[model samples]
Target: MTIRYDLPLWRPPSEGSSLIIQSTIGCSYNHCSFCSMYTNKVFRIRPLEHIFSDIDAGARDWPQAHRVFLADGDAMSLQTESLHRILDYLHARLPRLARVSSYATPDNINRKSVKALASLKARKLSLIYLGIESGHIEILKRIAKGASPRGIARAIQRASEAGFQVSCMVILGLGGREYSERHIAATVELVNAAPPTYLSTLQLDLHRAAAPGFVPRWERHGRPFQSLNDDECLGEMARLVAGVAPARPIIFRSNHASNALSLGGILPRDKEAILRTIAQARNAADSWLRPRSLRGY
Candidate 1:
């Protein structure tokens, strides 16, 4: 039996190896200005029977699949009971099922109580990927992120307390050149306040062709978007590395295809090394950065 995935399925870079089951058709909140991921499809939860069919097919083919990432966009936005049913079925079919993860937003986490989260964690749905694009309120509003920095921190901490592995993502140069300082400073503050288990960075590359409204939405605030060049982007990354003082160790990465330079290590431990590399990249950009033609969103 073949599983039919909707066109343009998206998963976190880390979930590249997992069995992907489409719990939903598109993003529940498709209003973010910078995202064109789900603009083609309207949001709707897949029927339970349809989802179960894909699960059974996946198990039949990959009987020992240990991890599954529910797609598309925010599967965590589904109701608590709905998630429980899916998790129950997944364990029933895949004896080696060790983890279940999905993309999530602050609103999704906030809507679920600690008890609900703990219950889900018990069922092995224990990881969540969040896009805290920028912590600066002005930048957030300008990008139509719909969540505040403090609120994001609360959601991250809440999930952590309930025994979930939280992966947070920050978009480098999201505020472009104008708000670079504010963006990096606020992001550092948020991460320090509520550090996630994994922290990653993806440089901003507005898919104007995919998102026809990106420019209009971004220009809504009457500010001209001045995107940071390769060196400038590296500088923002350096400032972020220098400013972060997490309460605990955090796994950091900047190897997304969009990043100019790839870097990964545990924070506070490899902080200096990462910063020095960023400095080197800034100084010796031609050698350090990926060729401009090699990068993708």
Candidate 2:
């Protein structure tokens, strides 16, 4: 069997080995100033029949597959009944399929009732990747994230209550130098409020295309859009790790390819070590961090 993915499919770093399927065509909300991932395509959900065919082909090719990721931004944006049918089909066709995960926006989760979410979780649609971007409302507005910090916290809490394992992500230099302190404080506040099962941080990549939109916004507001240097970026991440105190145990990771330093471990237990590692990385020369030429979106 031959399998061809929809052009420009994306999955979380942890989903590297999962079978990929496209249940949606593009992001439901693509207006974020920092993102260029789905700007080339329009938002639309794929038909159930087409999704089923893809699953059938996937099962034929990888019968031993244990994990599956629905692609093209937020698959959770699909109607509840649609998601149910897809999950049911996958379970029937792929006996080894243990979990189904997807990127989920705050709006996507908000649109579904808690009961609806629980039902999906019961059917093995277990994990959601949520991009919180920044917990500071000002930064969120600057990035056009279309969500408030309160709203994001509520959505995350709802998902947690529904028994879905949520992996929350925050961008280290999202607020640039202008709002770094407030961004870190607010992000810590939000994370502790709705404590994710996993927390990952990625450095803000000012992709060439995104620069035009993001740069001008800063200029318009008479604020300097000064991105942090490698040392400053690491320092900001260290601050975040030091400040966050989740009630539940949360796995922390700053090992994304875009990061200046790679660190991972359960929080509180490894917090001091992670901060020490960041301090060491900050003292290192620029040559030690990931070079710009080697980075990608």
Candidate 3:
């Protein structure tokens, strides 16, 4: 039996090939001003009966599958028991399943206790892809992120303590030109405190859907949003890399398709090199950066 996917499927870049199961529809908090990914749909958790049928279909067709990504924004929003049951069913049916992962919001992570997180981790839900966006409280507020720097750090710390490997992401140009420095400093502080297993950066792209909601907010604040140019964006990236001093080694990447310059290395050890690469990108001709037309969410 062929399983049909819900429209507008999304997964982390690394999970491109993993089987994606939509445990939730849309994003529970779809109000982030910078995000347009889920603006077209309403948020709802998939029924267990439907979810189970999808899993059965996947197991029948892809018995050798090892990685599974629960989808549609934040699947971790599901109740602890519901998530565990899904994980249990996936592992039981696939037999070769090694990990079950999902995109998680800070709110969702905070909703569960460390004990609940530990239980999920024990059941093969080993990783969470968290979009930290920006750590500056003001920037978060401006973007309607509904997350604070301290709250984000504590949530990551709790997940880490629960033995969940976290891959956290920050938007490089989220604060635009005005708030760049504070954004970098606060984000570095947060990362240093929580220290994710993997850290990735994506340059901000103002998709058409997001612009309608985002622009007015900037206008209402009496501070016009000044987007960073290619050079300015690279400069912000350089400062961010240089400022981060994590307690543990973190695999870092700025190689997302949205990024003007591709960069990857372990933190601190490769810090100088990453900075130098950003410098080179800054010095390169305007044509060298990823073309604006080519960039997408």
Candidate 4:
């Protein structure tokens, strides 16, 4: 008998307690106008046996790792029993395992009962990366997020209540120039609604060919985009930081490479300083230009 793996697993830049497990192949809601990350593939979950074997292999090679991050768009799509089994296996094999993480959609989260999530949390399935994308219902619909602002809020609230640390992600320039202010305001509402322990910001990336649902219709008509300048984008981040009054200690990070200004610090205390740094950086850059990649999408 022979086994082969087709999926690719990527870890974060620096070595951390976490390791990524590519449980699913692509994104279910792959319609975001500005994204091309999973355009080439359809969403699919890996077989449970294969995933278990991979975990076993990693345990053999890197027993020191205590945190696992399920990857490839979203692992929340996995069946409830499957998720439980995976968590059980990880805890059984890696007794040192401190946490398990995954990207989750509101729809996916809503599908599972509160009891299921709490059970997973009890077994150290401790973190969730939710691409809330935008808090605006129109923006979410346009991007095919498949969930409303209310739905997103409910999902996050439930997850947090389940004893898991939630990391909610928002795209900085999601509304371009036209909707930037509304985007920011709605984001504040969204963040305030759930008040997660962590927040990450990513700037909008324009990928014309690969993303149909995400490219604005006006752009298709050859209209010039009114997207944010570096300064305005920074201002959005500043506003969100200032507005979210989470009861828990929140950690904020602008992790995406596309952002002109990278900012990270603990919330409530460092939020003001983080905004000031972004403001300074934006003033220095003056002209916020987009970056280029190897494939040139």
Candidate 5:
């Protein structure tokens, strides 16, 4: 192999076919209660020379590649100046490179100036995968997400203003059973106010590694977290699809492995059909939903 990736690397499902480059190691803010994706490593930016070597190798392997996904966690944590240099190197190495994307934390996006973001966008860092997680302020704190509803919305809006497409993910059962209704309501309001170009849903499936901290953190809110059943998870997803009436259309997806159902369509456009499928899945045994044993995060 021309390029060797750090083990346990991850990227959005859509980026599976793109060349993978480790621009950073782990997440900058590793305190999110419901996440274990980066618990195994400390966060740090890759040296520019190492990143350049990876790009050069990738070009030799797949010169015609048009898209690349920066990994291992939020590559956006790199300084604006560092990112500009990385983007410049990527294009110079891969003549066909058309887009470069990475997971981004809301804080990181908000930290950079709009002019910096716009410059990055112009250089083909055209999209970011943001995990809004949940838009409810209480949930945000309980999870130690390091971001509030307002802050996440501001990040999304700022990215749009910079002409960058944002792909945001919201967890389906972040609030569990007790706060399900409130979670969905708050999330709906936030998305309607600051819509993203794409939105994806992830059902709550706490990893054994993440569950230790995830449960305790939420209980600190004065209530024990109760896991949601498949039926309830579907209900929350249905409400999200039904309520996502954005001024501009949002491309919605629930294809994450954790979700019981895999759905895709444009909100406020294919809303009815999306809801109808969920409605029909009232029976857990319905062929419409993935079986319990098959579900994963």
Candidate 6:
């Protein structure tokens, strides 16, 4: 059988304002239990020659590729030299490329030194999308993240201090329903240490095929997995956001389609307002659950 090495690309709802680039195809860490983002294909880094060709194509296709986003699970796994060359080529092709961003794992980020990161920033690779997931060590282990919270913190701090607009993702109710408080507390601790410029929360949507760890596809059928109800999930989010100290100008967002509540604003300034919005939704007895009509999918 011929192997297909195509990278699966996806644009979020906000992709309307951004240009998409597939720097690397698929994900290096494809074992996460709750993810199916890259299961359709194996991971592979695109050749520099091919990437440059795509850049040329993009320039011709969209003369104004203002904000570029490298796609798939993570693009930071590319060699530092190759990444730098790609960035150089992107800027050369599109002078209007204001910002470039990509998904990065803790391992990918820490693999490069602070100096290397600084060099990349100078080349216009200004943003990094990190999936910190959760701060709890057990939850990290549960997700097969293959990295510790401290490791994540160090990598994020390195990226941030090196001037990358670090946007880290947090999964609300990640610790299952039982460990929500621990998840919230530990996540807050981690965020406090490596405060990112952007923080996004994705509510857990239990998908059997998307399971990312050692758990069997049928295991969820054997033992029930606990996930927070909608109100509980929102409460957990409120606590996490409210607990964060008013220090930096962090942008908060819930960018995933699975989330019932969509919240975005500059942190500290809109924290209270966001919380009040969630509170109002809860008070109004709104249904956070997708109606049964749509749940059969």
Instruction: Identify the leading candidate in terms of lDDT.
Output: 1
Tens-digit per-residue lDDT, 1-297, candidate 3: 566577999788889879988899999999888787887889998899889999999999899999999998999999999998999899889998999999999999998999999999999899999988888999999888898998898889999999999999999878878888888888988898889999998887675336454563576779877887777778877877888888899999976778887789999899988888777777776756777676765
Candidate 2 vs candidate 4: the lDDT winner is 2
Candidate 3 lDDT for residue 229: 72
lDDT tens readout by residue for model 4, 1-297: 222344544333221457666677788777666667677788888888888887887777777778888776778888878888988988777878888888788888888889988988888888888878889987777666778999999999999888888888888888778788888889888887678778888766565334565556547658666767566777888888888777766888875566666668998888778767767776667543334341132
Indicate the worst ten consecutive residues by lDDT in candidate 3: 207-216
The weakest ten consecutive residues by lDDT in model 6 span 288-297
Against the reference, the lDDT scores of all candidates come to 0.90, 0.88, 0.87, 0.75, 0.89, 0.79
Off by over 4 Å in 2: 208-216, 220-222
Q: What is the per-residue lDDT of model 1 for residues 17-66, given as tens digits with 9 covering 90 to 100?
A: 99999999999998888888999999999999999999999999999999
TM-score of each: 0.97, 0.95, 0.95, 0.86, 0.95, 0.89
Clashing pairs in 4: 33-214, 33-215, 177-226
Q: Kindly provide the TM-score of model 5 when superposed on the true structure, using C-alpha atoms.
A: 0.95
Query: Model 4 Cα displacement at 101 (Å)?
Result: 0.4
**How does model 6 fare in lDDT?**
0.79
Clashes per candidate, residues 3 or more apart or on different chains: 0, 0, 0, 3, 0, 6
Model 2 lDDT-worst window of ten: 207-216
Measured with C-alpha atoms, the lDDT of residue 113 in candidate 5 is: 89
* RMSD in Å for all candidates: 1.3, 1.7, 1.6, 3.4, 1.7, 3.8
User: Global CA lDDT of candidate 4, please?
Assistant: 0.75
In model 4, the worst 10-residue window by lDDT is 288-297
Candidate 6 TM-score over all chains jointly: 0.89
- Candidate 5 lDDT by residue in tens digits, 63-119: 999999999889999998998899998888888888999899999999998999999
- Regions of candidate 6 where Cα sits further than 4 Å from its true position: 1-7, 208-223, 287-297
lDDT (Cα, tens digit) per residue for candidate 2, span 174-227? 898889998999999999998999999988867543634456356668876888
Screening candidate 5 with a backbone cut-off below 3 angstroms (N, C-alpha, C), the clashing residue pairs are none
* Candidate 1, superposed: residue stretches over 4 Å from native: 207-210
lDDT of 5 at 220: 74
TM-score of 1: 0.97
